[model samples]
Target chain A: MMRRKLKVAVFKFASCSGCQLQILNMEDELLTLTDAVEFTYFLEASRATAPGPYDVTFIEGSISTPEQEELVRRVREESRILVAMGACATAGGIQALRNWLRLDDVKRAVYPNPEWVKALEHSKPVAEVVKVDYELRGCPVSKERLLSFIKQVLVGRKPYLRREALCMDCRRKGNVCVMVAKGIPCLGPVVQEGCGAICPTFGRGCYGCFGPSIDARPEALASRLREIGMKDRDVARLFKGFTGWSEKFRKVIDELEGGAR
Target chain B: MVSGGIYSGKFGELRKLFNALRLRGYRVIAPKLEDSVIRLKEVTSFDEVPYGWEDIQAPGKYSVREGGKHFRHGPDAPKRILYPPRLELFRLRPDWSVEYPKERFPPTALFAIKPCDLASISVMDRVQGGIGDPYYLALRKKLIIIVENCVEPGATCFCSTMGTGPEARDGFDIAYTRLDDDLVVFRPGSDLGVELLSELNIEPATDEVLRKYYDALKNASLKAKAPFELERLPDELELGLNSPVFKEVAERCFGCAGCNMVCPTCFCFDVIDEPELDGGAVRVRVWDGCFSYTYAEVAGGNFRKDLWARYRHWVLHKFAYWVRQFGVFGCVGCGRCITWCPAGIDLRETIKSVVEWVRSRGGS
Candidate 1:
């Protein structure tokens, strides 16, 4: 039952670094976490760095720039298990909304000299660029799930993640079905069950912060929205949120917006 | 509160049963109005029950109004408390040894449960007959069921059609029909129920009171609609696989699994393994539904990838497959799925549409 200390690293790309901050927020398990896995290349937590060839590397955020794409490729090559954390690293996050627009137009509008822009034309999740062994999908990444994943990896077991719709957790919490009771158009049916069905419990519709579930039915949900008086454009805009770049949601957005809004 | 225990007070006093059960170390789970929904929750006092509140339900709409006559079934059913949405199965050691949880639950009494819900439990029992769920069995052994006849059924109620409700004939310890005069006529179905009734200084229900209760029950049974042509449903669903109604229903469905979660019979679940920091893993079974996309998924591919297929699977299974599997109808005609559907997709309407579609092709 003797276990060797595993080397762990947390890297960031084109994100707000909120997912990395979630790691620090795990204060209760911080000591136990460090004891299990030796921190190797996390710049956010410590200045001291360990060399490459790490056992597990967690990449948080999307690759928006050519430099970031190349760095993610190198990180993938160096790490044994590259786990994508957060919506950005898993489903392109909110930054992927920029993928819908022309990159040249965006560059010209933001910068006077468009020629100076060295970023990739599209902001993409880490999985789109490199092979991800596992994904912890969420807007900022669930700290509890991250801790569980790390422990499972350390024990040579599979991490448990609920891939059901948000409604499952919402019902388990005994929250009155908001969509049914209040007539609110909720994305809970198509959204992944993480974040503990937070938004719906708080009396707000899910904005797909955890991204779409494995077999989400955005088109079907969109039809419900339309039946409930939401315009096609509005439904499209709803899907154009955090996980807009995900295939299922992207297809829904395209159909609702007729490929261009 | 009376001198001679529960029966001494008066005929139709529900407080007696409530008090007797509580005194016997049973936690009474009753319908309590919370957050604008009548939920099946634990109640400590009789005042906690929404006595006068009447629920008005329609497709995609539900509301409560004061001065209503009879109690209507709410979104919360007995399944929520009994089966539960999430249950811990076992734990795994670093050596991969399985360790099942030995936690004991409190003695529970489901108060005022409707006939349809009670019938659903029968169906569930049949489904779990061969290899009974240890967790469910443990909780069930310490459970008491008090069934309530629906003297005034809700608008969406179709239990009469299913021959499962308006009155509970079996699978319950005690059954009661609340009269208009506030007198509740009690009927004992078990030895324990008769023993409890004998302890109470209760008088036999008078002929007049019995007559009134029967009339009300009769009226409710008459109002009940059996929309499903059950004999034709199996053949209809089998032939109507390509029916456009499936697509129409799927269009409005969010695949939220709300219907499945609220259903008294659905027992599907997904197992989750949470590894502890100490190299131990806690395996838990969380509720899952066929409506969920991942429910039919495997490493190779998803079986019910399309929403239409998933919706069809849910409908056919409830109507056809369950009959073949458990020798009982999966649906007790409780109508929770209709009232709780965010899209207002009515199962009665859906079944009727399928029947009509089958008939339109000149087939019985």
Candidate 2:
């Protein structure tokens, strides 16, 4: 008796498609993954689209337009479980920096014909528009993490996401503290563990691509960044990265904008 | 057999010890300077040990330079070898068969270790050894610890305050103090140390050279400081439990748990069940800290929900609770926490805050 193959769908809105690319980067494991699940609707990978009612739907971008908003809500209704993948789906990626600016000015600067483009006033994560069952966060999501998520889902077990800070991974790897040793302002103390603290392992500071962890004290980290000679606006800009629109990081950006920097 | 003999040799003679350890089939874990950071990693060659390079460590600042005559300190500790950050305890298959992983405890020599780290090993021996953890105990038994006494302690060092360093009294099989770039003084602590030193083709120490070595040890002690006396620390921490200083320090703390990660005596761990799609589960253990927000969490809610509460728990556990638990302070006062913390939050300042809180009420 053969078990039914899980029907999976990958959707994108306004992202670089890097997170979706992680599926192809899975090496020989991609073949193993294909055997376990049928890719029902992957627009980037294939032109053929099957109507949803997907077992699992992976949303890869933020809802920056009215069409994406409608699609995400319908995907939520059609899927048993909807997982928002990458920084855009979890916490509106770098595009959310426009949330601080005038929407018309942002559109005019990016597009030659501002009237031709269609976008909402502010880009929002999938959770803001529709309930997201899970999130695999990163600028470009980790191949290992995505595989682990699928593996757990296949086993009918809840996927365990890490709540620890990126610094924990850095410490475990016995990597020298770039922020402490080099005076580089790092967001490892606030960002969640997912990428295995890759930046710090290479003697560089973490750029907070994984968003805030359970123990994130952004105000405390922001103040530390300031004490290390980072200018007010630069500190604000530092927090305004991939996960800037998230609550912990958004609070820092909001406070800085409110003249607390 | 007489133990605790002081011997003298050329600096290059230490290389002979490395050779002998390898010949005995022991992996030598020595300090190797790589990419500017001096790490206590496995080295096949003695030349890998950065002899004359020392690290300048301060609150949130560390760098390596050539002028210093002492061996530099790094973030890597001997604990990683004994009690690793992540380990698979066992695996349970679908057939209900348990597969225990082979012990990774190889015969290893901890070569050229500092005094503060030596003290940590002895402390962990009691902490983990007391509980009779098979892995840690097995790894501990296989170690050939060699200590390098601090002639010039790093900026973050406070081993003297903790009575753990500048000169290692015990815990190491063999100890050495660099007299200069070439000349060296050796002190044997155990029977194996005696055997190793006795076989050495080196001269006996003279009174004049020993005098100079003693002076340097004394000088190293004077350089490291404590905010106040630590004799009444547990009582002081008790009095300052409800004080505002913990909250004040927590304000600056990023809750990264950098201090706990770098601290020599921290031993908390979290157990996780990693179930595979093949119907197998691996019971894994990874390092955990009180400063972590997820610590003390249950099904209903987290016990230490606020960052300040977690921060207070860590400080109190190190100073007060550890005294009650192990009859010794959990913190060895190595100051690795201070040097490694991104926030530059110094425990010296935090300890002083506790003392100030205790003094404000005239309790002292």
lDDT of each: 0.82, 0.86
Q: What TM-score against the true fold does each predicted structure earn?
A: 0.92, 0.95
**Model 1 chain A worst lDDT run, 10 consecutive residues:** A155-164
Best by DockQ: 2
Candidate 2 residues lying further than 4 Å off, grouped into runs, are A258-261, B1-3
Chain A accuracy as TM-score for every candidate? 0.96, 0.96
C-alpha RMSD by candidate, in order: 3.2, 2.1
What is each candidate's DockQ, to 2 decimals? 0.65, 0.68
Q: Where does candidate 1 stray beyond 4 Å?
A: A100-117, A158-160, B1-12, B93-99, B199-202, B362-364
Report the lDDT of model 1 for residue A4: 74
Error of 2 at A34 (Å): 3.0
Cα lDDT of model 2 by residue, A71-119, tens digit: 8888899999999999999999989888888889988998999999888
Clashing pairs in 1: B7-B201, B12-B184
lDDT of candidate 1 over B205-236, digit per residue (tens)? 66677777778888998887856656667777
The CAPRI-style docking tier of model 1 reads medium
> What is candidate 1's DockQ?
0.65
- The most accurate candidate by lDDT is 2
